[model samples]
Target chain A: MPYPEELVSPMRAELTRLGVKELRTAAEVDGFANGQKGTALLVINSVCGCAAGGARPGVAMALEHGTKPDAVVTVFAGQDLDAVAKARALFAEYPPSSPSLALFKDGKVVHFVPRHQIEGRAPAMIANDLKAAFDKHCAKAS
Target chain B: MGTFHHDTHELHGITCVVETRGPRTWVGRVHEVGPAGVLLHDADVFDEVPGGPTKAEFLARTAAVGPWPRHKSVVVPAAEVTSVRRLGDLSA
Candidate 1:
């Protein structure tokens, strides 16, 4: 069962507050995952400890980097089941993992961070890892 | 006992301890096992760091208490998995 909306609202806000678009439906996921432009970051948001402790905070810090993806988006796991499933299908080569981040370029996955990478790492370390990926795969933020 | 592939369906629904090639270990009920990898539900993942509890010590502790329940679902890729054991068999 999904957690109550009230319970996860703040969790949702963490990214949305940073201008990350929240794709709450499968159709929305399709719209973003397909026909993407230069670069995009797709975050499989979760209510797990690693997500709270690392993923969200890490992404927030990474975006502060000068070079970053053209767009950033998220689909909450469990709460937005179909949306998360649709997004996961985009990264079929990888196992399904929440709090995962996929960097897409021209509609292809260029880089990915699975749950294992975020599980024990500090937010700053996660941010640095993401910053490196952004530097390699993304353009300088305008 | 009927003979079957130990790495396949035999582990489904069983709570198992999964160790990966990296720092991550997972304790969860097996959901699926295929060429892709093992899928676990209600998984508790422990990522061992330098100077932290060794995998054995962590497993023993988990066996004594319980899995940490960190992830709702997770998949350990076939290439990354090192071993899988029944958590129940561990001597806490």
Candidate 2:
């Protein structure tokens, strides 16, 4: 069963406050995955402490990087079940793990950070990892 | 030949303090026990790092206060789990 909306609203706000688009329905997830043209970052947000302690904060920090994805989006795992399932289908190569992050360029996932990487890591470290991915995949030609 | 069955079924429905092989620890009620791992409901997963609360301290605080329900549900893989104890067993 999904969590209470009241319980997860604040958690959703953590990313929404940073301008991350929330994809709450499967249709929204499809729209983003199928229609986005440039580099986009998709986050599978969860209620785990790793998400609270690092994943969200890391994304927040990485957004400050000079080179960043054109779009940032998120789908809450337990709360937005349909959206999360649809989003995970885009990266079917990896196992399903919450609090995961994927970098997609022109509708293809180029970088993925699974939950195992997020756990036990600090926000700054996770940010660095994302920053590196952004530099590799999102950087524009001068 | 006799077959020995090991199961977390006894722990099901009971609130537990679970420790992973890595830095992560979880406190929650056991919801499922499968060959893959144990699923925890209303779990609070913590990572014990440098300058952070030790497992004992965290458990003590939890015993004093209460379980902080962060995760609605999470499956801790059997390969990663080290121990599982009833939260009620922890001394305050």
Candidate 3:
């Protein structure tokens, strides 16, 4: 079952406000994965406290960096089962973990940062980590 | 994994097939792909022989850094990479 609509409302907004396209269904994830050209960032958005306090904010901060991903998208972990399943399917080489971050180039999971990396980190530190990952995997628009 | 096939570039969670100096192909997650070189994590070494069989042995390994834990990742130089691909996709 999905989380109550009112519950994750703010959680959804946290990323949407940053212009991160929410992949709310299987087809949406399929489309995003197939349609991507060059590099894309996938955040396994969650409703955990760490997510609210750090992950979302960190992603927002990372986007503010001069360099940005060609496309940024996310899937709600508990709310959108199909979407999350499909997203995680793409990242099959790694074990399942929530509130994870991944980078894909031409649709391949090039980089991954698991929950172990995010659990206790601050938003700014997460942002810094993402920015560094972005600097490596993501290309700044010309 | 037959019928579950996919080109690594089209699939997610892929390994690098970097070719540097000799004919060695490396497998690992890609860190960065830039003009200078590609950085890889959790890298492993392999050898591909033309018209011959392919063999992958743990001939090489590296410690991961930063957000990437050393146990599951490594840093690899992708400058001279001849090609990159995923071994295959997971279940549908």
Candidate 4:
């Protein structure tokens, strides 16, 4: 059954407030994933304990690093069904996982963080993992 | 496993979304679409989106979405999409 709007809205807001764009439909996912517009950070958000306790906070802190993606966007799994399906299309080679993080540059999957990585880890540790990806993929700001 | 690593440009050819059906059918959005494993965002509501049901009630009433395995991200085709919306800069 569809998740009520109430439970997912705050999670959406939390990501939105952090400047994370919400891809609510398939076209939007294509628009963001199709073109080579620098690096984009795609966060697969969830409502699990690990997400609240680790993933979300880790994402916020990781963005604080000097090197980062040009854009950061997100989608909720159970709620935005079509949108999530569309976004996953961009990762043609990889399998699907929730509460994951994928960094794309020039429209390619450069780095990925699977669910296992987020389940038990602390926010700080997650941030460190993301920061390391940023260092390797993100372009240095001039 | 080992620490995640790769070039950002390497993601160009992959799909960023995947469609999978199980006990509860729904789509997954790829937060980070890459070769390693895609990050999926499953939509849900809990005292947020207007007209949505309450969290407590939602949990009590609805079945969980899935039991997706670890270390895997699905690839969705672009043709299945219906629309796209930008949350920020509503004017955009």
Number of backbone collisions per candidate, in order? Answer: 0, 0, 4, 57
Which tens-of-lDDT digit does each residue in B1-92 have in candidate 1?
Answer: 11123455877655688888888889876778888889998788888888988888887766644465578888899999888987756731
Q: In candidate 3, residue A35 scores what lDDT?
A: 62
TM-score of 1: 0.65
Per-prediction DockQ: 0.05, 0.04, 0.02, 0.03
Candidate 4 backbone clash number: 57
Candidate 4 C-alpha lDDT tens digits along A45-138: 8766556777888999998888899999998877788998888887746556667788998988898776545655688999998999999989
Sorted by DockQ (best first), the order is 1, 2, 4, 3
What is candidate 4's DockQ? Answer: 0.03
Query: In DockQ terms, which candidate is top?
Result: 1
Kindly report which residue stretches of model 1 are placed more than 4 angstroms away from their true locations once superposed: B1-92
lDDT per residue as tens, model 4, B19-61 = 2222122223334544443344543222335566553344332
Docking class of 4: incorrect
Q: Model 3, DockQ value?
A: 0.02
Ranking by TM-score: 1, 2, 4, 3
Score chain A of model 1 by TM-score against the reference chain A. 0.97
What is candidate 3's lDDT per residue for B1-92, written digit by digit as tens? 00122442332233334556767656555556656665666555555667654543322222121122232554344556666553221100
lDDT of 4 at A21: 95
A best-first ranking of the candidates according to their lDDT comes to 1, 2, 3, 4
Estimate, for each residue in A91-130, the C-alpha lDDT of model 3 and write its tens digit. Answer: 7767555677998888887777665456546889888888
> Which docking class does model 2 fall in?
incorrect
- Which model is ahead, 1 or 2, in terms of lDDT? 1
Docking class of 1: incorrect
Models 1 onward score TM values of 0.65, 0.62, 0.61, 0.61
A1-142 per-residue lDDT for model 1 (tens digits): 9988887889899999999999999999998977788999999888776688888999999999999999999999889999998898887766676777999999999988766566557889889989999999998766
